[model samples]
Target: MPRFGSWLLAVCFFVSGGAFAGTTCPNFFIAGSAPTLDASLLSRTTEVCHTEYVLFASGVTKGPLYSAEHLTAAQIAGANSISRSGSWHQETGIPTADRSQSSDYTNSGYDRGHMTPAGDASTLTSEGETFSMANVVPQLHKLNAGEWEKIENYVRNIATQQGEVYVVTGPAFDPTTIPTIGKDNVAVPAYTWKAVYEPGVGAAAFLCTNADNYTCAVVSVDDVKTMSGVDPFPALSATMKSNPIGLTLP
Candidate 1:
């Protein structure tokens, strides 16, 4: 809890080679700080065995603390071609009722949206791992399929073009506003937040509110931190953030 979350990083991440450039899960270089974790929050880190990132699940929201990843150009180029594993399932120990499952949204009108999108995974194994229920949240269908998905693609494209990118993203909610979807009580977030970081280029974010037209606006990382309560990249303030193309999407 020394700022961004060095303790959680040590506890949750285990060093690995290759695309990660020798780092563990819950990478903090992108955030410029490790979250100051709260024991009372009862959050726990669970490695999504199928992908290269990690999940920090919230006991209250019963959703991802935020899913994180480091993506390289080579991986991004191949990520689009891989098919989804369709392997959504619950984590061990967490009560099934507090967890989100694929079945929970069968007819619930929301999308079983991925916090760490399948398209962000570079390999078949990693791509498939993204399907784990730990990486999902009950997202608004249009937001999930359109704006949110567009953000994912845009991040990957930029990362590939400018070396590698580190990202952390997830949903936002109000304690009194959880719209529980299934019998399991998987919560629907009021907003979805995403932060992206490139070492030299700096950090940026998006706040996609759950709505009819979910086109999100490019935001300051500080704005995302204030709203999400998770600072993925602390150094990314409005003045330092950049949108090279100045483009907005549907």
Candidate 2:
């Protein structure tokens, strides 16, 4: 249990597009991590269990435009003894009550894939917080467990190796008319990408398209923009920008 009001949050997550600042989006980006997009179409913020997960709403879909988080190695290690054990719960961050619900994923075929993984929930509170719907996207089962999971595990490994890393991840919804899950019409992204920067070590990004035998695409930060129309990492220093980790397998 946090010391009453002593649970100080170190990161700030918000939604921006046009003049509306209330759009929900995740704050996975830390202080001065990236530059804000000049033109945002829609943004929304959702709050649940006294915690806020900022998510950007898409003009194309009612669900989150994306879910994000900012985490450190120590912050992730807070609950070292706990195991991965928790159920998916509802999130009220979206404007519509029905939009961000647990049932929205019921039989939707897509897994409620976590952009912010559950491995970080090492404490009672943080563990439960990891279940927030605002932190998830409708992802395929194979992709979620396979390539995406590999990427997440690799980042965790980096956290253990170098100490800390900044991560921002979510879906890249294709502009063409696409399939949506549940009644809320949450658009299914053709691909999903995660942009990571390990301060002293190195940084790189990759994307996993949803499919059976999915092969991921290792690309640059600018390449991510061509897919998702957003700059997750803005104003990067020379090292991280120039030194991207290659997607080499073991």
Question: In terms of TM-score, which candidate is strongest?
Answer: 1
What TM-score does candidate 2 reach? 0.76
lDDT digits (tens) for residues 1-250 of candidate 2: 1211111111011223323233223345555433244254344433232232234444345454444455566755764667777677655444554356677788988898887677755576676776776667788899888878888777777766667667767676654446887766676777787877766555667767766676686666555544565556664654555456764431
Best by lDDT: 1
Ten residues in sequence with the least summed lDDT for candidate 2: 4-13
Report the C-alpha lDDT of model 1 over 6-109, residue by residue, as the tens digit: 21232322112111111244343554344432233434333342357766676556678677777788788787677766577676535554566777788998
Query: Residue 123 in model 2: shift from native, Å?
Result: 1.4
Candidate 2 regions with alpha-carbon error over 4 angstroms: 1-30, 33-35, 38-40, 43-60, 237-243, 247-250
lDDT of 1: 0.64
lDDT of each: 0.64, 0.59
